[model samples]
Target: MVSDRIRILFNRIAPVYDQLNTWLSLGQHRIWKQMAVKWSGATVGDSCLDVCCGSGDLALLLAEQVGLPGHVTGLDFATAQLAIAAQRAQARYPKPPLTWLEGDALALPFPDNHFDAITMGYGLRNVTDIPGSLKELYRVLKPSAKAAILDFHRPSNAQIRTLQQWYLEAIVVPAAKQFGLTEEYAYIAPSLDRFPTGTEQITLARQAGFATATHYPIAGGTMGVLVVMKG
Candidate 1:
């Protein structure tokens, strides 16, 4: 079933997304995003896209890489989030000009083999069809183009799972309560539960016809990055 619930939720939380991300991740989200963008291997003059670009952080970083000639696009289904992203781009002046598009990740708006590289941050868990979304990402990327996607991970170790649950219920919930988004913030735990593990993600990437797929677990397995290379 195609549901608008996630879109609605993002629209409702768009204003606080960046701030909360920083708080929740203890300012480490930026580094993770940096690593994901780096893993994409988006060099100078490369066309890149940041899928589910909540506030254009990753897209802005990508623009820095693509420099003068290259261009980057930020795509998201949530209009409110896109508005915020556009505002950020305007205020920060992310060079190379950014194109913010309101669209679905499972159905990208670009032509096949168009983008040289892609990056996504904290988005894979929310999509309804993970495999379909991955397929679309693989489709739009040019041959040999790379993608790096960063998202929350469900720790396979029991102790780590306990830590994750505690952090979400204690730190995350309390922080989001200030914005009256307790219920919305609570979705993270369940989303992690549904998210594929690092190993499984690589297999899914292979199934999507990518020539290479690898998952790098980071932050003690609480976070992971799925890196892929198009054949």
Candidate 2:
């Protein structure tokens, strides 16, 4: 299903994934991702993990924020994406202390309570086992650490939901086609459709043993950020 399709799509588009993201979001994704990092309350010396770290955008940003004293690990299952991420990391910031690992979200290859903060951008919905992935995230995050998840939202309001659907179905897919990524982009709507809404994600976070779970709807609820604090 989506799990297989996503793996294939990302592997194929890894080289151009970051460029497509900027074009797709009109460069606003950077702002949204930065906001997600800021909302996590990550400090200068925090150890951070960026799961499903496509092209290492969030990882690089977190590394810059944490400075040389802190550690940042970006994990992704796709080798192609990881290659691109490594190239970008080396080209712009040579000798960065950040680590990029090829790993799965369901079973992270890290010790328990290892990371001070964990962030996932537009990735949770694609996980085959959403709840299981959340549990793994909670297990690795240290007590009082924050996990921020940012992804496309299914708007609860009727009018806004309709518009969001139109944008995804009509605009996004078509635009991606022009960029020679129509097949890859076609997965967007279905993925978002299967993803939980803001409220449901908050509840899932709580069920996964998060002490404090909060949801923020951005861009008029067309996208959402779920912030969960580990106990």
Candidate 3:
């Protein structure tokens, strides 16, 4: 079960989460998410689902890519985050054929084989049952559909790992404080530490019934993208 404390913490910090993320990653988070979206191979007229969509960044991007004929659903458990995402969607895209729903990742409210493609950005780490969540994603995605996940990874190289630690602890925390989100930012390192590595995530994807899985390292292995396709 997801701890109440973590949910409350995220709801409380939702407003500033996107801003803090940009600061913490020096605005690289957007690039990483965009890369994941591109790797998903979603095309025009494809229906896409973005679980743990957060502020709807990937959802909007995918919607834009899929055009007016396609549909995009952005789902998250945090109301505050969803509210912000709704407001942004209204202000920016106006009538974007996109739906924003407040929901859970492990128990998606969709029927089996519903979506053409699915993407999760910086969300797998926050899930309490990563494998279970992957299975749920697979269940909702149509046969032959693709799923792309982007998240932080523990660097394998000793020197790069050390540098990553320094970057998160030193730069991220302080930058977050500037945005009045020090406590929220402090969660980054520990969360990444607790998260499975890229290789492990690939294995999980396969175990979850993905026909094929691939991992792409970015930022010198500090971040990773896992792409999985259903048989």
Which candidate ranks first by lDDT, i.e. highest?
1
Best by TM-score: 1
lDDT of each: 0.92, 0.89, 0.89
Candidate 1 lDDT for residue 129: 89
Q: TM-score of model 3 relative to the true fold?
A: 0.95
All candidates in order of TM-score, best leading: 1, 2, 3
Q: How much is the lDDT of residue 19 in candidate 2? A: 80
Q: How many clashing residue pairs, candidate 3? A: 0
The per-candidate count of clashes, in order, stands at 0, 0, 0
lDDT of 2 by residue, 1-231 (tens): 756777888898887788878887899999999988987777798899999998898888888878888889999988899998888889874466689999999999999999998899888988999999999999999999999999999988999999988988898888888779898888888888899988999899999999999999998899899999998
Off by over 4 Å in 1: none
TM-scores, one per candidate: 0.97, 0.96, 0.95
Worst 10 residues of 1 by lDDT: 88-97
Give the distance in Å from residue 94's predicted Cα in candidate 2 to where it truly belongs: 5.6
Model 1, 106-182: lDDT tens digits are 99998999999999998988999899989999999999999999999888889998998999999998999999999
Q: Which should have the higher lDDT, number 1 or number 2?
A: 1
